[model samples]
Target chain A: MEKGGFCISTMASSNIAILLTIGVITVLVIQIIYIINRSRKPLHSKSPRSLSTLIVLGSGGHTAEMLNLLYVLQTERFKPRYYIAAATDNMSLQKAHVFEDSLLGKEAPEEVGRAEYMQIYRSREVGQSYITSVGTTLVAIAHALWLMIKIRPQVILCNGPGTCIPLCVIAFLFKVFGIRWSSIFYVESIARVRKLSLSGLLLYKLHMADQLFVQWPQLKEKYPRAHYVGRLM
Target chain B: MGDIDDIAKEKRVVFVTVGTTSFDALVRAVDTPEVKNELFKKGYTDILIQMGRGLYIPTKSTAENGSPALDYFTFSSSIADYLKSASLVISHAGSGSIFETLRLGKPLIVVVNEDLMDNHQSELAEELAERKHLYCARPQTLYKTISDMDPGSLVPYQPGDAKPVAELIYRYLGFPVD
Candidate 1:
């Protein structure tokens, strides 16, 4: 009787251990699959379909550079585009209008006007305090997440800007968690001839951008991972 | 004090633009009596200031007479119109202003806004000055710098083609580049 009781106890303990081992293994497999999916390359197809692109427009020079870049893209290929800018950046919004007008050019204004424009809270203002920046950054992040959910863009393109940080972060998080599929392309500003701007530095360090392009060869040398694509503006 | 016609005939017009961001320090520097005297001595009869959301308003001064030789606006979208007629451009070291001035082939003197977070403008001003494309001036020394500037000596800016930038974007988007 004593021998039988001991055998039963041992069997129960072994069963528990086996159950725990299976649970751990299951978790490991799920984790591996998640990482693989997150890191997978963006979808590529031989037969091209129209892609929805989210372009983050920074104020002033960034706006100008981005407009210059957009002018060269095949507009038909990147249909139903969206533009995101800071709420305070009236100039950028105006520039976007100018860009749209230039593309429309007295022909089919209503069709091209389908490209949407939205604004996110600015993360930082010139001469703002650090504490204020932190608060605003949080608000900006929330706004960016909301916009991302609404847009569900296939890809995001941004030149260097502090305002782009929150959107990039939200996009990266969504990509990692399997909430959405989107690739980020960061083009270092033409003004950044020698070094990456603060935004560029952060995005590169975090691996948020799938592809990075620098205008100058020297900048590419500094950031080996970044492709030297020559000047854009 | 002199008449507008008299000053226009005697002195070169200098356009002082601060872009879209407020640069009260630059505006204040330009507004000083000492700076005004220096400007007058240097043959700048008319100073058109594009203040751009600045709090400081140039006080109406009899120094330039009733015609208000110092004309200022809070903002204007058509800065190119002003740029066309100005003999010299004094501006804050914003890239937009720099590029626009360069595109217009105007001789520019850039005063870096040191108060900015990264001081990128100072670096840009130095770079442009090194290339002989523009001159860099300090807020304190703006008047002196303008007094000595020779706009004719500055190198004409050559704008780069945007095609390369467009091609890079195309390649990144997986579109076939022609």
Candidate 2:
């Protein structure tokens, strides 16, 4: 009789375990759907005019393309900008500083909508073998998490640079939580006429980037989610 | 540091820039006597080569006996300053150098560094070239391209406005557009 009781108890526990698993999964799915619907909430009549913007700058070509994008933006609306670059990228930050200063006709951009410069460690350096990048990538992500919490930007903008990946992912995490939903905007480099860049591909696949811009129409055809901006650089 | 205009008025300069990456083939191609002879025929009095990590460096000389003056530098903080003074620009197929020169209304010949993976730069160069904005050439065919160059036939590139992109960003962010 005791053996039959033990067997029944074991069956009951197993059934409970299965029930718990399904319950957790259902809650998760519901939460995911809720978040997706929440992200789609458009501007109401009460939306704020100014945004705390985070601009991801990178070496050479990426920096130049980003700066060109900055020129199009109405600086006042994107006030109190945070410019982020890889720690080793000295030129991008300086160029962005000069650009912001130029906007205000000043030597230093002391108050060009309160612009600030931030540097993060690059997850992978140019020509770095992928074997060792795993560790460095984790380190970069941790560093990016810290920066993202500090900035908590309303909008994050990046071109095709490896440095932006960790930050964009963290921004999506923010959305997952009830933290500020910082929308990520990615612009594919004009030089990449045919393929979506590795960075572009990542953000697209993960649904991290809210809007993806491609200079070439061919890229848009391949990446259906991408908007054909037509020669942004 | 002297005026680019003053220098440009003195003698027609052809600026050959390999951009930041080494394109040794372009450096070597420009150094050829055949290419130099063609440049001279086109009334280019001087050549300023921004070598950019190239293995081979061209020897500098003055136009003593009507031979073309040749000088080269490794890199510069302001390649735009050099581009401003040049009558013609032969640059590696870098978008930065290509657009900077084109936007300045200078005639540019974009040379493809075939060594780079997939030759992505060629696509950008070819598209612009088709629009009659610049000439596209390979290192092997640079001499032929330069010899047949017609700067007057090229059209000035109108810089694309980013206002539309800005508006899109604003709309997405829910910032009301003025």
Candidate 3:
């Protein structure tokens, strides 16, 4: 009985040592992965090109307006590297005109019209209720931050809520040195526009924006930095 | 002839779609006597009311035993087919609906989103209205505008004017000058 007990104790210690070895191996593997991911990340911590611009048009009308702007850019001589992040859900309006690679500034007009629906859903969920689902909101914020950091745009231009809200947060946090931010709106006059609700009230409160673009001349008096650029579409 | 065919032949179909953002609000606006009466006066008998995105009209009738005033198509791929045969299209001033109407070259009456943050649709409607391509009105003015629409005067979108808007955008985005 004594001899049997000693053998059992030795077997138990061997099993425990094997388990500890496996656990240590797992910890080391995880550490390696973490280190590799951190090292593989791009070294460029700031905007790469001195003149690169990022334009984010939230899902609907703002996207349409941005599309018009994109169309204009195609005809112009300026070759500044540009990044356009459009809200995914609103791609139905521009599906016949823009493609994923093209919107990313990768391809030509011939490749322009083919849209990938995944990108659309990804962009559209911006400005939605984040507090309603924190997991989804965090994932969205992570994706936007990833794209903005990778692109490292010099100036970020915003039209409205979804993409702009997140991109603004990202720009404010990680912008290194030369990058700036601006906002634009298509309004005929303050009175001509019907302020709908809380968002409109919030929009009126964006007093600290680097600059504001309005179509009406009268708005210049209210938001002095609001450049009267006439009607843009 | 059968009842389906008879209904199809005599019925000049109209499709009314509104923004899903404020479906209840839009339905309330359309429930007014003037808007409902104007639909009857406009010669539309068979109507399909589609609430795109958010709003879903629960029943064809608002109350029990109510005569079927609206036929709800919750989500149908055949919407385009209906648009092709539709004598008139009434919808909110969403870019998707407005673009589709222009593509089909159909006469339309658009109600701008009065409840949106910036009233962005108002700008879009006014721009299209300025070209005389479509009729636009707020909920308050909708009855008057819909009553004044002349289907014979409807015109398709002309492409030249679109370029200027694009050009202005390029300048604003600071694309390189040649």
TM-score of chain A of each: 0.80, 0.83, 0.50
Higher-ranked by lDDT: 2 or 3: 2
Error of 1 at A164 (Å): 1.4
Q: What are the TM-scores, per candidate, against the unseen true structure?
A: 0.81, 0.88, 0.55
Q: How many residue pairs clash per model?
A: 0, 0, 8
The CAPRI quality class of candidate 1 comes to: acceptable
Scored by TM-score, the top model is 2
| CAPRI classification of candidate 3 | incorrect
How would you encode candidate 2's per-residue C-alpha lDDT over A1-233 as one tens digit per residue?
A: 99999999999999999999999889777766775555455445366767889999967878898998998787777778999999998999999989887898942454457889999998888788898989888888899999999999988889967889888888887776658877788988878888887889998876678888888788889988788887765
lDDT string, candidate 1, A55-147, tens digits: 999888888878877877767667688998989888787788788778898547545546888988987877799988899888887888899
Over 4 Å off, model 2: A1-41, A106-111, B1-10, B64-67
| iRMSD value for model 3 | 9.0
- Winner by lDDT: 2
On DockQ, the candidate that comes out on top is 2
DockQ of every candidate structure: 0.39, 0.53, 0.08
lDDT of 3 by residue, A20-134 (tens): 9998889766654543343223223342223445555455545655555555444213234344444445343343235344555755644333222223114335266756557
- Residue B2 accuracy (lDDT) in model 3: 98
Ranking by TM-score: 2, 1, 3
